[model samples]
Target: MLSFNIYLYCGGNISMKMAFRPTDGWRWYFDREYDSLMLEVSSDMLFRSCYPSKMLIPDVFSEFSFSVSDAASYYQFHNCCHSLNLTESQKIQLSINGIVAANFLKPQMPKSWYFSQQSTEYTPKVADIVKVYMQEDGLEVCMMVVEVGEHASLCIIAQPTFFSMNKTFYFSEAIKVMNDRLALAQQFAQPDNSIVLDDEELELKAIS
Candidate 1:
């Protein structure tokens, strides 16, 4: 069986640990620096799906590697699978066959999104606009916020292909936007109505 050393950050320090190996399924690894946990499914397992299967992996995961951001995201993802009572191999099959559903496991916003849910004041409203800075490419993307629930919000990027594209932003940068909005809200002591993306702001480019 293939194995991988998973590294997690605790108290600002990194520690390595071996992921659990079941009789079948993928290997999971937590690479904290990337703020995402990686899942590697074997080619043989993927081949089990016949042609025209919905189990299509994105080009980004050409190496059969998939990832979910943060522990909460992973927890939400696993819960969504209804695999808590299923065997390891069953869980793998569920994930493979339910690629579209698995996408919802990812956090819509940053961890602060959850924290803000506990406080009504910080909860994002529908049509709330926020700026996102993509550190990897130094591009800024504008997100129109929609409240998912008391604990989360959906950030829809403003782009022509936004609905069909897979776009991601750094959690840290999202937190910064939340902080800026909160500061503004506190200073104004009113329902801040800043939902417009600056015309001067640069538009985000598609990844090649």
Candidate 2:
């Protein structure tokens, strides 16, 4: 079945005022195209009805390949199977948009396990899945989640790294140093703005 979206353009970012909650900082939204919930900051998505969707989750483990294509078909599968729990607004939105859910599943937000809730209880098999999923998720979704210090699932706290993570440094000092380095890089990047100095002159200036 063919399905499409018709978007009416809204000018100049005018929007309805809504209550601002502390947890709303991520700006999470539903992506109809993928039949998945998406992170606004990074566009990382999780398949809701189907766990480990062939498109969203890679076929990295094996060569078998099968992927869900569009919103209509995805919705049909979700509806016929009754896999998803939809609210009143979600039902209405789905009726209108053909696929998009009204909002995120509150319990299954970024902090919670997206795919398997039952697998949360510790087992050797679950532990292996966690390690594998983190690698399979790759730089796009998994890296962003890890850098922010959030554990998406009980299974995967985070991946081990080679370097020791230092947290003792002051945030403000780090920002200041980063800004100074950025300005220095920009200075050298532009030939007109770049400062040229001889080796002896540079050494003398460094000594001074």
Q: Which candidate should be chosen as best, given TM-score against the real structure?
A: 1
Candidates in order, TM-scores: namely 0.22, 0.16
lDDT (0 to 1) per candidate: 0.30, 0.21
TM-score between model 1 and native: 0.22
Off by over 4 Å in 2: 1-24, 42-208
Query: All predictions: root-mean-square deviation over Cα?
Result: 18.1, 22.1
Candidate 1 lDDT over residue span 1-208, tens digit each: 1111121222332111224223334444332333333444332212121112122234323333344332333333334433133333333333332332223233334434222212224555543444433433323344444333554454433221111112432211222234322211111111122222232211211111
Tell me, by lDDT, which candidate is best.
Answer: 1
Model 2 TM: 0.16
Error of 1 at 6 (Å): 42
Report clashes for each candidate as comma-separated counts.
0, 0
